[model samples]
Target: MNRSVYLASTLLICGATFAQAAPITAISELSMSHSFIINGGSEPAGIEIDTEPNSLTQSADATSQVDRPGFTPTDTSDVQVGNSFSDPPTPFEAQRTNSQTNLGNGDVATASYDVSILVENDPDIGNAEEDPIRRAVERSGIAAVSNAADPINAEAASSFTNTRDYRFTNTTDDAISFNIVGQFEAEMRAEHNGPEGFARTSGSFEMLFETGPGVDITYFPVAPYLITVDEDDPGASVAEMFFADDGAIAGVTFSGGASAIADGTQVEASLTAQTRYVFSITLEGGASMLLETAFTQVNAVQVAVPTATPVPLPASLPLLLAGLGGVAVLRRRRG
Candidate 1:
């Protein structure tokens, strides 16, 4: 699934002596996409379902025109969008919640904070998933025709946290082989191109899948799982985790620039007859950008596998089971 959201346009102005004609600009953007696929069974042809893809976007732009005439007027603006949905027996559930704040003062400066969270889950069984993307940017500079006398400085920070909790059960009377496969990609970039201006960006991300009882993994900054990009440095990182026995194995990678780091892995879980298993995914990341007349952003996507839980029983299942029991009793008496 592919999704993109863009928002925010504003101009900041202040009282200052027109010593030079300079147009200073500050901008920050952040977005994320996620996808999940469910398929696979022990014997019978595997079944698969696709979750409907949903997207949300928010944005703001700030510019300072101290000496240039005929420039766009300094106007403050903000935009927001959010939605959430839940339907039982539906293959998809998603929610987008966001909040933003922008500030400006006497100086030719701007600051903004944005937060957005995406969640999906199966409620009846307490299997929940939540993904949140957060970013903060602050830019300060004087409008000067020459960088020798005035300079522009801007800094942006971003973080991501995602949790996937699943409960798998074997309804059959005999043990069965259940498997899951995951495809993951994580990418990040921060760049700057201007005379006498420099740019630097860095970030760290990790993903992990664990098995146990009551394994509730909620919270940010979970142990680094995917990749970490250091300040002013650009590169990629690879990491993996495995469950014991026929359990599944998965991996994810991170890289700088627009190119995405991709990986694929499969996990086979040995589900005991008439037993339940709890598994979870804990993913986290943090990024920073510093530049002049430059931009920074991060993108992370994951294609999750299936959760093998029995389908809902039909309304007549009870009567049918009772009838079968009576027939068995009659057979025993005849024998």
Candidate 2:
């Protein structure tokens, strides 16, 4: 059987005095993605069955390359092109995982996943000392909750990507099943009364699967909802909206503001049923919060199944049904 993939999210609410905002230098923008594929060929004429599943696997990998622009002799901020420069490249990085499984019986499945958070900060926010983006970058820990110095700047971003592939052989003597899984999640938390906390995410996935030969496969229902909120709850919150790709996939949209008296606000996002989580939690005197989390998991298997045979019904069964019908007919006639 093919397991159905789902997208969902949850919120873990915490309370604390809003803390002060941290100095942030994290990248003002980011982009990330994931993908995979599988193909199957004809089955050989053999009198044997296989029981093992082979795989092409990829796990938590954060490999990336950095490229900073080169300066010309006259283009240098200081003197000559070779002059030492004090500026760094814009912060844009990505990570991903991909995997594939092959059943000896001519069946295959492939999956891919990736997620990232990007923050754009203003150099004018207060230089490196007061700029929220730069200070956040200084820490290698959880990302800092800070926005671009202004809306005109690059808006902070969260990215997610996923792809899947599956194929099965053409042998009637074999039965196989495959399930592709993809997931992602991210969150931001702030102590109430002081500092500010924020979080947001955006992602999408594509998957494919197939059963071998004349084998049969069934897929479960897709996930139904992502975030369930009462827009009327009104405390210190924003707008929560949704978009769907028919019945196969869905997306979430959020917006809100924070203030002193209001403790905090959270945004939980779910990409798949099982989403890996990346979060940044902080406490401030005036705390405001935002969060998102998600994950996904599944397995594909190929195995022979016994066909069901019909047994002849007892001769008395038909007579018994007819007798009951006769009694009901007689009652109606009396009426």
Candidate 3:
């Protein structure tokens, strides 16, 4: 019999014999590593998966190229650039054990696995640090003040660029082996530069999979951008939001007046902004079978800070200011 046919027949017989079988306690661990660069920065990333309670852990470390050029190894807070710049990669590890009881069958089976993922930034590892333009750009009073108020300056901004890496592994004791894996990878670049604005760019890639030796498959989700809304206000203008997968505007819109979201608009809304909304997506036949389940909803909102007035300074503010300034200078030098 063909391998596929044989495997199918074996599974059918196993299913019948073990229809009501209970699974014995088993332990499993999973780890993954993935690496990718953003703009011009290197970052290390990884994820861990556990089976007992079924949970996943993911993390990333990133540093920008702009900050490295002037960075020194002795500078604990600074990241070095050029050939000397390197991001310390992080590893993810997980462990789990479970005992499953079959509702109707008497068959007993046990299966376990370990998976890992790692991501890293390479390619633009070393480069010179110079302003993009030969001359300094002009700034208005508002722009100057905004730049000064920025917690992360141009030098500190680069540190945000991060590289990613991922890896996964599985181990099983049962005669029948089964595993599920999926990934959605996309590279995005900011077309505009501002603290709060819309940026746009485009790229292409493919999603491939292998169930086992010789069992491989590939498919495109077509319109990759499945959902789009004001990251700040999902209820904002539907016209401002676009669903790439369908390229249909009717797929996403809100009754609110936030109709025209510019390319770089920042979304900030609270649950109290408005009632929650829901959107659903259905994939094509084959795609749907490959990726079961479709409908998902965007419900509720989270607001971190409340709107309030600034407190006024008292008459003795000058003395307090002088003392604070002295303390700040001392901390900086020591820091």
Best prediction by TM-score: 1
Q: What RMSD does each model have against the real structure? A: 23.0, 28.5, 27.3
All candidates' lDDT scores?
0.23, 0.20, 0.20
TM-score of model number 2:
0.25
Order of the predicted models by TM-score, top scorer first: 1, 2, 3
Candidate 2 lDDT, tens digit per residue, 1-335?
Answer: 00111100000000011212321111111122221111111222321222112321212221111111221111101111111122542332232222121112111111112222222343332222111121111101011112111111111122232111112233333433332222222121111111122222222222222222243323332444343322232122222222222222222211111111111233222122212211111222222211111211111111111124423223222112122222222222211
Judge candidate 2 at residue 197 and give its lDDT.
23
lDDT of 1 by residue, 40-127 (tens): 2122122111211331222323232233222223343333332223442222222221212122222232222232322233332221
- Model 2: per-residue Cα lDDT at residue 168: 25
Candidate 1 residue pairs in backbone clash: 7-59, 8-59, 8-60, 206-225, 206-226, 207-225, 246-268, 248-267
Please identify model 3 stretches exceeding 4 Å from their true place.
1-146, 149-177, 181-207, 210-213, 216-226, 231-335
Score candidate 1 by lDDT: 0.23
Ranking by lDDT: 1, 2, 3
Model 3, 121-199: lDDT tens digits are 3324322211110101110000000111111222111101111111222222212212222222211111112232221
After superposing candidate 2 on the true structure, give the runs of residues whose Cα lies further than 4 Å from its correct spot: 1-154, 170-200, 205-215, 220-335
For candidate 1, give the lDDT of residue 301: 18
